[model samples]
Target: MSKSFERFQRRKLISSYFSVTLSIALVLFLLGILGLLVLNTKKLADHFKEQIAISVFFKDTAKQVEIDELQKSLVMSEYTKSAVFVSKEEAAEQHSEEIGENFLEFLGYNPLKNSIDVNLNAAFVSTTQVDSIAAEIGKRSFVEEVSYDRPTISLLTENVRRIGLGILIASAVFTLIAVLLINSSIRLSIYSKRFIIKTMQMVGATKSFIRRPFIWTNIKLGVFGALLAIVALFGLLYYLDLNFPQLGVLQDLKMLAILFSGVFILGLLISLVSTYFATQRFLNLRTDDLYY
Candidate 1:
């Protein structure tokens, strides 16, 4: 009977350890997916910002030298990423190609004006800054008009802002819920060993002494879970890259490294915190409460 009872206790201990490790692994997996989503969303937003172009139309009488000077000025500006000059002839040729030979014959002359297309740095892509930039460029003597898709820029800015804010709020809410769920899981795992805790307490074991082994066990399991999550995330990214090379920018080594490091730290912190609190609660529990 004594040997059978000892065997049963060992089995229970093994089962409880597996359960805790599995729970932590599941939580880490969920967090990893959420992290990837947030990172990719940010990259997409930046891509959209890069596509916003500002068109600077040159005056009909504007000389090549004046246009060159204006291009130099724009290139030197803090807000500009790049300035590309499109000569009137090039613009006319492009329009003719699009409309075919018939349209050019009817028009008689190239009415397309010379223009400089300016790409702004992502930081200055906001609606307010875009308006300010247009106004600044309009003051130039060679600039007939400054044209940009104002409605499109405004829509992009608002959408990006709202998406970023939504992601932040969702991340916060998910993190809070994850922590609570992980804590509950850890508590239940510890509860399975309540009798052991009670016996240790009765024997006058110090709280630190009772907690050290559990904390160490949790740390190891947490690291293992995080590594598993990292592997899963890398696999997903690799698959995406293979299937859609257009999104290859997201495969940047630096960004992936940052995300992996963050997940590792998060996994360790969550496990350690949950273990500490769960163990503390068990340690302070009344003898009667142990029955539950």
Candidate 2:
């Protein structure tokens, strides 16, 4: 290549390198956020589930031993995550405090029954699973009644399901859009050097030899872009940690690792594939078509 030709090529390469990296980083950052939401959706759902506790009120005649056994049994059950026993006196005191009056004293005696507050596993938080679990638990001889707000559980499940579906659709659409934009941008960059590709081919350069440099350059750009995305994601997570401590705790390291890996792989794959096709297009084009 002449000194002028070499200079032009070098400038084009530098420009394309930075431009592509920024473009990729912007899209990947958005993708990282979406992936985080997708992962945390389950955590948020589980939090809502935890709020709908199963209150297992004991029968008036239930012996202390039988009540304790039932609490232990529920704690060991597949559905239960935790179970806290509330004595009749404690329940009465709690009710009195809520109303800012000694209702037990005014009523002449405590009326609240001993109960176990059970929290179910996230997997069993749905309406169907909860209903089944409640039915099974209610059958016990000591259980006077098993109660929870069915309407609240149903609302939470329905809202979460709908939101998850919407998010999934939006993520797929945005991912496709990002891929297309990256592809077009890469193609435009390569299009500037169609003549150079033709020159190499005419001078007996093998296709792989011609593609190697471009591929290597884009690979580096892809990695750098992915790193940028990770940094942005890290900042957002840090902010969440500072502001919303509870939600921040849902940021599992394993899930974050998977998301970062996904970003890197996505960036590398898109760059490599786009480079191959863009390079191949010029390799196959007729000399005169370089103008078009």
Candidate 3:
């Protein structure tokens, strides 16, 4: 081959490689964002559920000793994540701070009952479980009433569940799109080299010999793209942490590790699979079909 012609071929090959890698990186980045949302959905849900609590008020005749005992028992239960005892005075003070007035002074007496604010685990925060826990706690001798907004809790749970389901469905659709997109981009990258493959075939190159370099090179492209996507994902997360610190609570190392590993494996596997099938398309085509 002429030196100038060989140089031109080399440039085309390098440009094709760069194009495929860039395309894969962008697609993987989009996939990574969807993956993050899917991974963090549970953490966000748990955070909201942890905010829910039930207030248990004791009877007027219930003594401090009896209330303390019942509080201890409630805290020991698996359903109870935490229990905070609030004296009538503390309750009055809290109400005063929030309402900007001391109702006790106006009424000539403290009217609030001694209560325990009970926070449940995520699993127990649902409507059914919370009701079951409330009923069980109410059976205590010193407990007068166990109060929580059942309607509000039920509504919130339903809304969150629905939103989570919607996200999952959206993620699935996006994932499929990502696969097809990466496949098409890689195929087009390979399409540029179809004539070269035909030339090699004419020179007695075996199918494996022809496919080997393409498969290996594209696998490397997939890994590089996935790494790029991972870096971008973390960069976005860091910005979120700096500006919106509350979101930092959802950044668990274990889950993030899973996400990173998933991104890499997904990119690698999809690229390997797509490249194999993509090369096969040209391998099965006739020399006459190259123009199409």
On TM-score, the candidate that comes out on top is 3
Predicted candidate 3 versus true structure: per-residue lDDT over 2-107, tens digit per residue? 9999999899888888888888889989988888889888878987888888999999999888988888998899888899999999999999999998788889
Would you list the rank order by TM-score, best first? 3, 2, 1
CA deviation > 4 Å runs, candidate 3: 1-7, 249-251
Per-candidate RMSD vs. true structure? 2.4, 2.5, 1.7
The residue pairs in collision within model 1 are none
Q: All candidates' TM-scores?
A: 0.90, 0.90, 0.95
Q: Could you give candidate 2's per-residue lDDT for residues 1-292 as a string of tens digits?
A: 5999999978877887789899989988998898888887888888878777999999898999998888888888988889999999999888888999998777898778899999988888988998998999899887899999889899988999999999999989989988898888788888888888999999999999999998898888889999999899888888888899877643588888888898889999988998999999999999988887
Off by over 4 Å in 1: 1-15, 96-102, 249-251
Error of 2 at 44 (Å): 2.0
Q: Output the worst ten-in-a-row residue range by lDDT, candidate 2.
A: 246-255
Q: For candidate 2, report its TM-score.
A: 0.90
Which candidate number maximizes lDDT?
3
lDDT of 2 at 39: 80
